[model samples]
Target: MAKSVAPGRPNQFLRNLNSKIACIPMMLTALVIFLGGTVWTVIYSFTNSKLLPRATFVGFDQYERLWAASRWIISIQNLAIYGVLCLIFSLLIGFVLAALMDQKIRFENTFRTIFLYPFALSFIVTGLVWQWVLNPEYGVQGVVRSLGWESFTFDPLYTPEIVIYGILIAGLWQGTGLVMCLMLAGLRGIDEDIWKAARVDGIPMWKTYIFIVIPMMRPVFITTLVLIASGIVKLYDLVVAQTSGGPGNASEVPAKYVYDYMFQAQNLGQGFAASTMMLLTVAIIVVPWAYLEFGGRKRV
Candidate 1:
């Protein structure tokens, strides 16, 4: 019987090969699309392309021109300021709201719903409403004057020096809700025994939250920060709706600048360059944060 045994068929090897072969079409499609788009963008960025793309290469001249443009420079500066202010304000307000909501007070669900519902609304609508509210002649300014506080002038949307802050205020209105939801989720996941132990040791509630609870929610905090940072990097809608980057481009941001050049100014090369710059900036900041979050975890 042993002498009569025949060679086994290569069933396992054939099956493995067949499985890999089945994935080839989809994998090729993805690779082709990704590489094709990237190559197109790179090629266009080297040319003096217009509204429609062109093939005449003009080297880095567009980039030089973009750097020299005052509006572009102002836009970059405004974005930096707005990014920092929005990030800090949203985090602080959201954290405070979450902490308050965690106190097991009356109508807890109602309070959470009220805080979170703002995030569901469109930023365009939110920006428009804020714009009306901040208008000088008929908004907060008028109301304040009528109430006998004639010195109350809240016209940052029209003030060149303080317009960026107005845009930040609108962004915060939409952004803080997201932060609140995230922080609330983190707070809810904390162990109740931690609170009991803290109370047993006579640890103050605020101290417990600031030191112990916050430290435990590091991952959530990092996640919220990253989310907020990405939003800051691509900030456009609220600024456009609320201020239109105006009162002399005081509220302009990088995304809006890129958009204007790409379409209105018919300077695709410069727009792509700005887009590339934004990508680089995001990579520079996000890579390290992501590495610490993910790579640090793997090492641990």
Candidate 2:
């Protein structure tokens, strides 16, 4: 006995019915938790909530104060420097490592393990390790001085102007391995036939990679870019562990700023305002990419 379907109802809704049913809980969680929380945060950003949330709206005062604060300004500057360098170096170094690994070199597994081992460590561990490594008395500076290079100086943690760059070093070491693995996966997916064709055509290996293989890895690059960008935006733990935003707030970032305000300073509205701005920043990056990536495909 067949159960009759409703007239004019498409069967598409019933397709993968179990999968759809399974996804309902996830969808509802996203709607209720993420979307709802985002809306609540945005709403509170406009109010004068302090210690406790109050609905008393104060317009853009919180935002104005946030922008005007020197600490916030410095945090933004540090983030900008860290974000840009981290993106460029991570991609470049990762791709280079992936390319080297793709050469069928001897002991490839050993090399891959060595490169990727750091990523297994948490950021806190990475930060702490790097902090010691960069310590003036017993780190690189000390070791070099011990080797009789008495004038050599390489400490970055205590230096205010270069403190952010110190953080960048830890970030790169921990992150580059993951990026390399991702790029290697993309490289491995490339067809052997393409390489054969390029070789037969007398193309240089580098030129082939530059002109053909990289373009084919657009999806991988985009995914890597998004991952790195998100990490940069929400960066806090590394800074906290490495410098505690010290050397007088030189390594302070937006996430740290928000946390310090919301909890430490007991200023909910200011924290929410900063968080809203962070959301806006993410939206600005994501919306256009989403449109170009998906919308353009639909149009085609």
Candidate 3:
């Protein structure tokens, strides 16, 4: 006699396979977009292409020219400074705003809306406004001079050594709100009993937040960090709008540098090389954090 198979196992397997099959269209669409664009960029990077891409292969000549370019090196260094400053300021300000907002203050909803409104606006618009406000001849400098303070001077955008900080200030203004919203959601989700228990034990509010609340919000903190990291890698709009990488490319970022080569300079190969380098740099910095956050064991 022949052995019989289980009744539902085959049906369940068929169901699972059907479900995966149903998702194939979406998966293929994403794969096509991602892989197609990446392949195109890689192919262009290998050629001696200009305004319009040519079919001639130039090996590593573009990479060599990129390495020898001083502006490229300056742009990379500027990006490091801007990225670190933006991350630090955004995190600190966001944490403080979120903590304060969680105190059950009056008009909490209004305050929350006010703080979050900035995130709704595009970076290009924000950068333009910041440029006007920071311009020495017309902005803070003129305002201060009008107030009868001729000795006062604040010309960060024109000063090579300090221009990055000026850009950082604008970036922080726009980004901190997003971090606050994330942290606020995390704070609200926290167990109320923890706060009550700490209060009953005579623990100070600051101490409770510092020790209990912050530690419990690790996942949210990690999420915020990753969000900011991605923003740093793609930073371009603010730099363009505010300084236009001015004062002789003092405030240039890798993204803007890549754009210049790809479009303005008509050097597609170097642009792609820069893009690849940026992707590699971001992976190096972010992959370790991602692994620790997702794969590593939880700390007690």
Best by TM-score: 2
Q: Which parts of model 2 are misplaced by more than 4 Å?
A: 1-15
Residue-wise lDDT of candidate 2 within 28-104, one digit each (tens)? 99999999999999999999999999999999999999999999999999999999999999999999999999999
- TM-score, prediction 1: 0.88
lDDT of 3 by residue, 1-300 (tens): 123446554554456797889999989987898778877887778888888888799898888888799998999999899888888889889999999999899999898888888888888988998899999889999899999999999989989999989988888888899999999999999999999999999999999999999999998998999899889889999989999999888999999989999999888878998887887787798789677766686652
Q: Which stretches of candidate 3 lie over 4 Å from their true place?
A: 1-19, 297-300
Best by lDDT: 2
Question: Which run of 10 residues does model 1 get worst, by summed lDDT?
Answer: 1-10
Where does the lowest 10-residue lDDT sum fall in candidate 2?
1-10
- Models, CA RMSD each: 5.4, 2.9, 3.5
Better of 1 and 3 by TM-score: 3
Q: How many backbone clashes does candidate 1 have?
A: 0
Against the reference, the lDDT scores of all candidates come to 0.87, 0.95, 0.88
Clashing pairs in 3: none
List, residue by residue over 1-300, the lDDT tens digit for candidate 1: 444444674454456897789999888888788667766777788898889888889988887887898988998899889888888889999999999988889999888888888788887888998999899988989899999998988899989999988888888888898899999999999999999999999999999999899999998998999899888997888888898889887888889989999999898998988877777778898789778878898878
